[model samples]
Target: MGIGNWELGIGNWELGIGNFFLVFLVFLVFLVFPIPPFPHTPYRGSS
Candidate 1:
């Protein structure tokens, strides 16, 4: 089935914000408080 016209009217920013909150909720559920990981981490590989 195709998407409904009402849903399509919400547009990209609305979708993006919705997704952002959804992700935050999931993170809070799993981790309690979301502390983002450090950007720089050395890659570990077996020689």
Candidate 2:
């Protein structure tokens, strides 16, 4: 039972890391090429 739980934890950790990298990659892509519809300075109301 303990070994099974350990394996499950490792699997979940790996999955989490994979998701983190995927999100990071997507973020980089967006930064490199932002969409036209969305305003660049959404945070600043002055735009």
- Every model's TM-score: 0.42, 0.50
Pairs in steric clash, model 2? none
lDDT per residue (tens digit) for residues 1-47 in model 1: 01342254357767656666665675465455433563332221221
Task: Name the TM-score of candidate 1.
Answer: 0.42
- Off-target runs (Cα >4 Å) in candidate 1 are 1-11, 33-47
Query: Worst lDDT window (10 residues) for model 1?
Result: 38-47
lDDT of 2 at 15: 62
> Candidate 2, residue 30: CA error in Å?
0.7
**What overall lDDT, based on C-alpha atoms, would model 1 receive against the true structure?**
0.47
